[model samples]
Target: MTGHVRPYRSYVYAYPHKTAYRPLPEPGPALRDLWRDERKDALSLYLHIPFCEVRCGFCNLFTRIGAPDELTGRYLDALDRQATAVRDALGDTAPVRFANAAFGGGTPTFLEAAELERLCDIAEKRMGADLRAIPLSVEASPATATADRLAVLAERGTTRLSLGVQSFVDEEARAAVRPQRRADVDAALARIRDARIPVLNIDLIYGIDGQTPASWRTSLDAALAWQPEELYLYPLYVRPLTGLARRTAVTDRDWDEQRLSLYRQGRDHLLAHGYEQVSMRMFRRPGAPAQGPDDHACQTDGMIGLGCGARSYTSTLHYSFDYAVDMGHIRAIIDAYTGTEDFTRAVHGRYVDGDEARRRHLLQSLLQARGMPLADYRDRFGAEPYDDFPAELAAFAARGWLDDDAPDGLLRLSPEGLAHSDALGPELFSAEVRAAMAAYAVK
Candidate 1:
């Protein structure tokens, strides 16, 4: 008899909130001190642009809707001041040698051309000329992007753009509360291509309410017509406190199956069209490396996040500031920055404490389809996976969830493993590691 597949549920268990974790110790090591010790393989920078024309129903990122020009100006000033503070804190530390710099958003295009240039200028001054060769990636909503904006980005060294093109079907877009039109995406793509930026990524979402297999196919076809250099496909995740969570319920089993099937179909389609899976959910033109794959900066090393609601990680601790546009939080960050008190202490309480270096090494490696290198693991942590996680590694291998080999030894997740990656964290990691991760989940 064939096994019965369960229907897909729209709701998923929410990860733990960051507040539950303990705060870091006071007078901890300075930013420069930390960077000096980080593995110099590669470093990257993330600049958060927290302004948005409108917030999507499924988005839980830090942003404010209908932000006026004056507010953006104030935020830019704050960003500049913060960058200076970081520079001052680094004093005599080694300069940053970044492999890539990303401007993630709310919507990066929401910023005026001047504001974007100013931010890039700040980065260039601090990170130096080395960053010019690095891929500068920025995300934009198609409706908000313009030729002038694309030109400005290209002039400032932005080489790639990730366009949020969630769905081609108007009804599906409405259901997801994304107010972009198909025509806007087409025009924006043309403008971007014309700017001579070598890479363009289109982001598509599946499993949204009102989306059917046919609608998904149409979305894929529409995206293919543009021949974007890259594609990122993600399933709808109904995050808590989002508009969609309150207004709708996701309980369609067949719809869930259709969603996964569509992802597989999309992957195959892209591959046949000459795109390769550089990583899960990411596909790029054949022989063209996905932006920053060789550096492995995002997952391998902890990044310094400088913005409201951004999270930062170091070798020993994790810190995050809640720039949620919540008046209280904003006031707290401001007060902290102005020396009303230690704002870092007040706004960004410590979320996790442990061997963050080892944790990052393991998690990032496992997340990548190719897995982690055994030698790198031993070199960093002073022990092999088998020696450190003997029982867990053995059990995982027994279940065919991970491969056990040196240099090429990777903790790859089989289909069954991929289905349970979240759960496997607790099972594979040590109790200390699990506790550190759990601490970050506290509200």
Candidate 2:
């Protein structure tokens, strides 16, 4: 930072934000060819359900509230078709294996018990992803994590179930426009435990209106009661087109300070409770059952995604269906997805060239508390990160964000670096990507 940098510039979950993606040229690369030369073994399978029971004010995820008039069934049908196409593309000519799988969305549990079974079947029969053999994870909400859904998921080998309990305090929940009582959240936790999933991840948010240090701790303790194997402490993002964006305009420094305070408090509290920091947003209990294949690395491994909201990542490209945040645009995209049939070629995506790839690898790896290994970077790119990004590394060090004491061959983030992850992560984005995002038609 030159002088004063805003801490919450943007969240860097994925490189080259979806906004950068444009329609692939006519006769875009076929899925078959896309995987023909790419590594198939140890791929990650992702199924996205774009329907949610309700949209939280702080949420900007590609999900719409409520699926009406058999919409859920239609969506699943499209997913099945897409899965079949993808499976055919990655033909058995070479090794094709799924090391891990995940069901995410508005809410995977938004479907009925039967629908949940069908969803699992699509992943298994259509895509050849052995859910039972791999680490399969699913996301749910308190209102939808019913016993029947729980039974179906457990039977199909869902190793980790992440429930979005943004806040356990009723007033704070209301402030964030995430409607749910603490009672319901508790019940959901009970159902999750009863299902015997190996890991339970509870997500909590900070910076909700009127949130205080005391209330934040209360939410943490409430979640801790379940002894969840993993905890994700998210700093609320009030992006445009979200419910909060319409109802609140909080872009002041005080809000940033408050969020930073809550974040530090939550981080220290989790550490005190024996949870290890995996990254700025992720904390895990020591020795918790690993969520996915031990060798699968997000930066290097390929991902096969199904459904409108899911984004597939090849080594050279990241692609997905039309992206939108406004409710009307989201609904229209879902409709188009359900109506489409030939799921053979990549449609909308941004190509990842070598420079972007290096940035992606470095940014994603560095955000983690464990940090990126210099040896890994050298092995992948045959060049050190410092060679590719000397100035960025220098700047991080000047700000006291880069850890000087990282073990032998690793590049790690200091506690302060981790705290300002949102700000620092975006600092690694290439200029072209920044321009694309700035000019993106967000709606």
| lDDT agreement with native, every candidate | 0.64, 0.90
In the predicted model 1, the residue pairs found to clash are: 7-253, 8-253, 16-441, 17-441, 17-442, 20-442, 23-350, 24-350, 309-323, 336-343
Per-residue lDDT tens digits for candidate 2, residues 235-308, read 98899989999999768998989899999999999999999998888999989998753312444549898999
Candidate 2 clash pair list: none
Q: What is the TM-score of each candidate against the true structure?
A: 0.83, 0.98
* lDDT digits (tens) for residues 1-443 of candidate 1: 12433323222111123443344466654665655566534556777877688879888766667555376666666666666655554445454456677888688898878888877886777545244588888899987688878878998878788899899888889899988777777888888888888788899988888777678889988998888888877777776567687787755666557666776777777778887665446677775545775323454344656666555555555556543434344445543433322222323444344344555566556645566767778777787766766776666666655644424554566544433343345454446544754554412
Regions of model 1 farther than 4 Å from truth: 1-42, 93-95, 126-131, 250-256, 294-296, 323-356, 390-400, 403-408, 415-443
lDDT of 2 at 216: 95
